[model samples]
Target: MSLANKPNRKLIATLAALLFAGSAAAFNLDSNVPITVNADNARLDDGKGIATYTGDVVMTQGETELTADRVVLYRDETGLQRIEASGQPAHYRQAATEGQGKTDAKALNITYSAPESLLTFEKEAVIEQNGNLFRGDIIHYDSVQRVVTAEGAANDNNGSGRVEMVIQPRSRQNTQDPDGSSQGQ
Candidate 1:
């Protein structure tokens, strides 16, 4: 069946929401935009309520985009249940709110679960937002609770197994002084 069919409209909408819901304050209008997917192949199984897309699958909604080697959608009678994407390194990017830069994430695998409202990034997961960066073996974001947790490699005997984070210092801008001159000059 065609993914653009009426029956699959809800599925596309749910997928858009799942992909962009990484941040609680994500661009509000992103979900309203139509989701577009381009892939070398797509297969839908109505019996199993699953859809799979492979070979350089790229999905986009508004300014948010996700690219992967393979993408799978799982649905139930209730609606969309989960989405999984795998690649050499699946990538996700979304335009952040005004003033903040974009948010970019990449991992060997990315998964979203609707029931838990969670997003998981595994295997060399890295997330960068507004000049701040986080890297770990596994990263989990709870959309509903707006919490993020990460874990380092489990089998690493070296100290390099620890997660890493980098936060950039804010730049100071010129401010008016009491005497009407620039204070930061």
Candidate 2:
């Protein structure tokens, strides 16, 4: 699937898994992940259902893994949210394993609004897709929209990454996408 395409089925269904399964990886249909984490300290806020894990944290969820000094999670009114994340140089991956594909990022500071699925990384942000990478001062991603945005100038250095800021159309907006369900195969 093209990350730049605004296909509807890919986005809304992310919520289906999170609401039913205990793990996000379990909820994802196209991906399966087995991840582990090592945190020096951890805390959870009861009323808000927010958790803060810190100290050389290494967490893996399916094919996605992140290593940072800290990771904060919470549930906003809309859905799961990442409060904040910071480390010496936090590393993250999506669709990364031995052979499948790789989308990785590194940042000094990371902030996310979970409900809106907005992730913003600052201070030397670098993201990779396949063997290529994009580097910038800041990078932001919206999961619901499946859009990745970068600021302060960056390049698709390896020629493997796409430089366009994708604007994914939601299902409600994609009356033009042809799934072929209406026609015989």
Candidate 3:
């Protein structure tokens, strides 16, 4: 859980062999950094500690970046409390360690709560990491606890939305033996 520690190489190499239940948040190292947002237009209510941004909003927090049509920031005396972003399909991306590829996410709406360290994506949410993809009607990610939950949307009809995932096969690599002898050697 500590970002300072290096990711398990064996785990990364064998990720494809692992059957993901589609209930884990993307691994990001910059979750504790400060967030910065930008937009063409903004309306700030200092008294309420609320700010609204429209027209191609973009937000960044360390290596993580988010883009949307509109974004609203809620803050208190202690600083940022929550962020709400909405668009036809908002975008989210973050770096994935040193050698791993980046993680990407898309959704119609994304809400982040600073107090709870939770991120909720609604309406056709999808996340792709390390060539694998996870899809669902709703995805809730708890950054602090590193827990994730994917939920299906419910309509008047039965089984409107279902969670889906696509896991790619791991590429073969030269691995060393337990005795530290190089396989190629």
Candidate 4:
């Protein structure tokens, strides 16, 4: 399907739905889950448990994966706190827990809070789920509350400066039951 990069009323509504629905509890990440990170260069400060990795960094935990040019892992005396990643456009993806789909996203800067399960994307952010695409200057997602917020950048540019989105019609296969269960088809 073609994507509508133009901004419109439907774009706003669809972006709202994507930002929220995309965070649905389909892939609830457990805090106790171990996270592994690989990078071309890494440095750790044992006193603070803060590690910085640079140059083609890849972090993974279970079905979730994040890749970036640089990634900084923050941890306190209690435990891991947050993960900050930056790149030309950092990438993130997670397998669907309850279905056969995935969530994919990219941004210049991406921050993930382990405790809150929140993800914040800054600068040319885009998220896609099932064929829908949402684009904006910033996209904030609260996994716990299942809330998403997207907004355009506030520059003195001479334009509408509105968020853009594209929503595809649901496929027939996605609407059908896998067990070939049909009541009155």
* TM-score leader: 4
* TM-score against native, each model: 0.73, 0.57, 0.71, 0.76
The ten-residue window of minimal lDDT in model 3 covers 16-25
Candidate 2 CA-lDDT value: 0.56
TM-score-better candidate, 1 vs 2: 1
The predicted structure with the larger lDDT, 1 or 2, is 1
Which regions of candidate 3 are displaced past 4 Å? 1-34, 155-160, 172-185
Q: Write the per-residue lDDT of candidate 3 for residues 130-180, one digit (tens) a residue.
A: 557667789876655555567777753655667766765544122424332
Q: Which candidate, 2 or 4, has the higher lDDT?
A: 4
Write down the RMSD of all candidates, one decimal each. 13.4, 11.9, 9.8, 7.2
Task: List model 2 lDDT by residue over 34-151, tens digit each.
Answer: 3366799998786887888999987766655778999886656654545577888888766522232345678998776644666677867876543334455777766555555555
Off by over 4 Å in 2: 1-37, 76-79, 96-100, 153-185
* TM-score-best of 1 and 3: 1
Q: Could you tally the backbone clashes for each prediction? A: 0, 5, 0, 0
Clashing pairs in 1: none
Best by lDDT: 4
**Per-residue C-alpha lDDT of model 4 across residues 130-168, encoded as one tens digit per residue:** 666777889887776656678888765843466777765
